[model samples]
Target chain A: MIPVCFILIILHAYVNKIAIYDSFVSGAKEGIITVFKIFPTLLGLMLSVAILRESGALNFISKIFLPLAKIIGYPCEAIPLTFMRLVSSSASTSLILDIFKNHGPDSFIGRFVSIMMSCTETIFYTISVYFMSVKITKIRYTLAGALISNFFGIISSLIITKIFFHY
Target chain B: MLSYLWVSMILFGILFSAFSGNLSGITSAVINSSRESVEICLTMLGVLSVWAGMMKIAENSGLIKSLTKKIMPFLKFLFPKLDKESQSIKYIATNIIANMLGLNWAATPAGLKAMQELQKINIDKKIASREMCMFMILNMSSLQIISINIIAFRSQYKSQNPSETIGPGLIATSISTLSAIIFTKVFEKIYFKDGDQK
Candidate 1:
């Protein structure tokens, strides 16, 4: 990736000399400012997670899905992972790793949610991002569209599990 | 009415299951999760701060503006009605740039700003203008250069080869973006045919 970017850099410099230097630096600069501006959101997500883990809230939360989770062959604890996919995909990715380590990827939850991940768009987050940027007050329709897709994602996951893992 | 039906079915399922405990737990998790989002977003500070700086320097240095100029021809074909001087156009370009880098967080402001800009040119207040609609569609089905979410998911799951998903994601999102473009065009032509019947 680095080599490719550098090559693009060199090529741009050769042809669009001024653009190459200016935009690259400016884009990187904006990236820096954005990072600082959003610092609180990142900190809040991590700290809340730490509290959940320490408070046993994670397990308590998982218990809600226990009955249906068993029927679907998923671990109830995977529920938090599902929500985590919204806040931070990386964190959810780590959670997926733990699930595999704790129960193996072959387990119901891993395979099920994995497929759901592929099918569903990040609904609420996308809306919030757009809202914040555009400062739009209305979000009803967008939310509806995303939630509706969530059903599609759930169905797709179930189908995927049946095709890939059912005995 | 149709939406009403959908909402009712969901509510009925929730009530009938009486697994309120399960739901309550899920709700709490969701609440808890929402609360934690700030920290996780913050934890990414180290990496994003540098990248954001790089992006800003590129902007201040005129990298982004030039790129927008370069892409203007192609963008014109995509959104002809948009005025070049409009803030919406600038926002759209910036948002798209952020998206291309998989910087969804940064893209939000650009996207929102674009919408506000679009509102200025809205015609009869009947429905969304073509440019506004297209912007929303493109933003929603954005073709990402790197799907940070997917990469993160791969990491969380502890795959021996987490990066393998990159190829598949690129292909999948490419298809989705193309589809979004095609669909938007079709919907517009079908729904907003320009001239009145003879």
Candidate 2:
């Protein structure tokens, strides 16, 4: 951490090229334009997300994982970890935070789900964005691999937590 | 190192910009407004450095090596075309572990290196080779057994115990990982099977 701080400070001091700033401001302006270019998609994504949440798509989905949780001797809250994988981590973090607040952070559900969210990626979003950027239409195996990892994370979290802390 | 430097440089530029301009200005107008600028470089550098350093530590701990060895047989069955001694394979294992631990810091370098190595074996520059595509696929849907970032975030938010999510993390990520590999195998069978038929 100290080295990181020093390097950042020294770099800021020595590399303060005014011209670079000008160039940066100019580039930032253009980057902003490009962002606008993607605004509709971004907006659409946000709206879809809003719809998903408000319309109870999330609640409906979480229920789907409930049976799996019971069968595996894990808490049902693991569903959010599974659910959020398709969306953004920021959103998932918010969910995890909410869970922690309501259920006490130390509760099995809160901690396990929180850790699971941290460990995984936003698979659906990544696949959609990357493929869209590359103009690829295939919806192939991207989510599959992510799902495999999600399973490992969920089950392992349960086992690990039970053996170590919770149980 | 160079790229990390660039990202960091970019980050500082953005931060200082906060002081100079109206915070309410159109964000997009600014992106275009700042032409040929290199602000992103610094931010990227800082991010890359932290992650790379973490990755180096993971490697040094021998955890990566052992995990690779433990999973080698299974990985081999999944990616049969890859040589057992392939550096790309080793790198792929590292990347997966990084992904599992939610260590994007360790994962990205190994990912980039894996790509570079995969590129060497690829025939066409335009299209990703099969292995490259597969690696990308696995990475895209990576499972997490120990979401370190989530734990850190929780800890930051003052969760009395931050890393309390390990149990659930393992279960959720395992499902995703299993499904990913299984589907990849099916995809391989279909794609490669057709190739053989041709």
Candidate 3:
């Protein structure tokens, strides 16, 4: 996918008589600057997320949601992934791997988790990185809107997986 | 908002650890994760630079501009307040397209670029504009048509059909993206005073 896109872009630049190398060099410079800008935000986000997970606070919160998840038809085993999905992608991915190991990939829970993980984004991570890029502190209703959409995504994931896998 | 959340997370983590007798776990996590974050950023630097470089070539070659023209109506509907000629529109269109193509690395730089452009037009630098919120919501809804990573993971785990989740994944993500658009518009109406009303 990436190679094809790069080939097409380079071809177009060549055809248009653009200084592809210089343009790339400058853009790469800007990209490095962006990484520096976002570095602190990433550090801060990872610290808090890791601390929460290690201290068992994340599991405590996930436990609290277990009953509600059951009532809503969300698999209990997925509560951890669903909770962590909002904050950290890497953590949630490991959780999914753990689930697959425990339940086997062909099991209902495994397929359900696979679908859920694919359909949801790590909202907090993306928000902090993007907002910090512009130094915006007062994010206002962005969190609210994101959570609303995330709720719908989880619900729809559950329904769709059920319809297709019938598990 | 981030400040409060960050503080709360740290505070709750420490307090919970102390009570749970897991203070040592927190210590290691803090040290390990800080290092891990830097490692992740180093990896991201390479990916971001390549994507940004390729994107620049695409931009200079008028590829992104032409693509933006194709999606202008959709972009306009989502961001009615933004001017058609604004640079952010081009970046926003690129971000969305890259995301739909499952080009995760390409999407972030474009998204960050779009945010920077949006911040330029924002009357208040500290507060997020409506368009910024809408953009973030759309991104968080996960609009990709195929999840290549998940398929690979399924295959690694030896699922009978690794790609079986594709159909359901696409359906679920489309539903989420659609709902994200609707809810964002609804929130805009309720929270931001309409232009006509004023």
Winner by lDDT: 3
Tens-digit lDDT string for candidate 3 (B50-168): 89888888888899999999999999999998889889999999999999999988888899999999999888898888899999999998988898888888889888999998888
DockQ for every model, please.
Answer: 0.16, 0.12, 0.81
Per-residue error for B61 in candidate 2, Å, reads 24
Clashes of each: 64, 92, 0
Model 1 interface CAPRI class: incorrect
| TM match of model 2 to true structure | 0.54
- Which portions of model 1 miss their true places by more than 4 Å? A1-95, A98-120, A132-167, B1-19, B22-34, B37-55, B123-128, B148-160, B195-198
Go through the candidates in order and give each one's C-alpha lDDT: 0.55, 0.56, 0.89
TM-score of chain B of each: 0.72, 0.66, 0.96
Model 2: residues >4 Å from true position, as ranges? Answer: A1-44, A63-74, A77-81, B1-129, B141-146, B156-161, B164-179, B194-198
- Work out the TM-score per prediction: 0.57, 0.54, 0.97
Candidate 2, residue B132: the lDDT equals 56
Task: Give the TM-score (vs. native) of candidate 1.
Answer: 0.57
Model 2, retained fraction of real contacts? 0.24
lDDT, candidate 1, B129-157, per-residue tens: 56765676666554466655655555565
Model 2 lDDT per residue over A123-158, tens place: 555444433333334434444555665556556656
Residue B72, model 2: Cα distance from true site in angstroms: 12
